[model samples]
Target: MKHPNDHYYLITFQYLGFRYHGWQRQPHVKTVQGMVEKTVNYVLKDKPFKVLGAGRTDAMVSVNNSAFQLILREEVSIDKFFKALNENLPPDIKALEISKLSDSDSFNIIQDVAEKEYLYYFTYGEKMHPFCAPFMTYVREELDIEKMSEAATHFEGKHDFQRFCESSDSQDDFVRSITTCVLAENTELKANFFPKKSYVLRVVGKGFLRYQIRYMM
Candidate 1:
């Protein structure tokens, strides 16, 4: 049941997760959610509201597109709120859009997600610029790109990923189908400080276990 004065809205945004610990709010720590909440409270003059992220990102993991649900004790103009929110949010974080949500929308972020894609970027043989640390992992050891590329296919299809995941028993199931798993030359993300040659491990599936992607890399 909806509360008398409560309203729900969906906010889409992106953030560079390097500075913050992660997306979740924690006491006495800088976090993406904490920054967002602080800004919201500031803009709304300390109005009561709660923010719920669609998913949590690990430290230093950037996101291009993500969403959060905002529950407010009172209604507010989305246009004005969005404008104010963007103005107050940190430079690394940006609000892309805002939309009102209703009971009939049939959207449950956790359950309705059809699939998720993860890209792990890395450059081998040399240390990358400090700026690239947030966007990609640097590997000092030399790697056989062709061999790694072929091995990536082994992770495709369904198999027991117990060892690759953390706390396998925490979940009801261990088998996961990686619809797309491959290693290819890095082309998706570009930066002036990035290495001339880099590769990315692309993985896509219905769901992922905690730290599964990192372990796979």
Candidate 2:
């Protein structure tokens, strides 16, 4: 059933975050939210709409899959609206799926999300191809894959990640648990620009403090 006052939509999309400043919109800054909202406004033909992201991603951080909650003032053809969004959004941003949201859900994506998975792709040793900059981090230093893999295990289980995250509120609980933490070969994502061999630091948890993944790498 639909709410009488509003229409809620959940849009799943992916983007290459290399050129964008970040997810949130800011005056005089290029941001993912800015681009998305601009395209949405154009597609709606100036009809009023609001967008809320499931979470925020730092600049240059690419996500394989992510979502945003869109609340439209008026009802629209889901198929038509989905296509219009894809047609207007930039090539770097792609919409994968769209679904109607129920009133009972409260249209709150952040609270609904139970866990998040992050993959930090990197390649060590020789310099990486310039084209790979957006998708992976290049490390010139020789990394001991064996040792790194072992050390990654230490991050498993519960611990205070206060040192790993960048937090303005120091009094907040920094303790968190890692359901999965591993340094593994990059087989999930492939590209012609990718190196012959690449690695990815995959982390999964209920939540993560700001910049924790970057600090881990």
Candidate 3:
């Protein structure tokens, strides 16, 4: 059942995804949601608050284009929220955009979110950059770039996706649409420090199933 306080707001933010366990604040460990919620309370001067994310991101995953909504007692100032959010939030988590929700009074953020986007980075070679190891998962074995590209096209449109999704007791419908699917490979990004190399595989899509990218690579 949906909560009575279903009012929603669209929050845009970026995170390192390295230090925390994941986006959802689990009872056991550090997480992005835990940090964000703690910050919201801190900025509000020690008042408890709640929030809803489009979905949860698993451990060791980062997001540059993440969206969520917060339920707070005090009125939120967009500019002030943006500036102060980072103050209480950890260095890894940064708020980019905060759009006060506009919809029916009972709109549920989880159900109302239209879509989401995620990108995974691949780094090759021996010498690694400071951020590379933490930010990117390493792949040295030769993967069929052309084959990966072909596979990406297959993922376009709708699919059962049950195979791609991580098994969960909560997952009911495994059908998800891919609005935009693209695979890129180039040598434009040359390292000035270590591992002077080129990326052979890249992918961007509207939505992703759990460990879908990891499964793909």
The TM-score values for the models, in the order shown, are 0.91, 0.93, 0.80
Residue 126 accuracy (lDDT) in model 3: 64
Kindly list the per-residue Cα lDDT of model 2 for residues 144-164, writing each as its tens digit.
999999888899999999899
Predicted model with the maximum TM-score: 2
Candidate lDDT values, in order: 0.87, 0.88, 0.70
Model 1, 118-161: lDDT tens per residue?
A: 88999988789998888888888889999999999999999888
Clash list (residue pairs), candidate 3: none
Tens-place lDDT digits, model 3, residues 23-91: 888998999888888788788788646788878887878887777788655566778877888777778
Candidate number achieving the greatest lDDT relative to the actual structure: 2
Global lDDT for candidate 2? 0.88
Error of 1 at 113 (Å): 1.8
Ranking by lDDT: 2, 1, 3
Candidate 2 regions exceeding 4 Å error are 1-4, 104-107, 169-171
Model 3 TM-score is: 0.80
lDDT preference between candidates 1 and 3, better one: 1
Cα misplacement distance, residue 91 of candidate 2 (Å) = 0.2
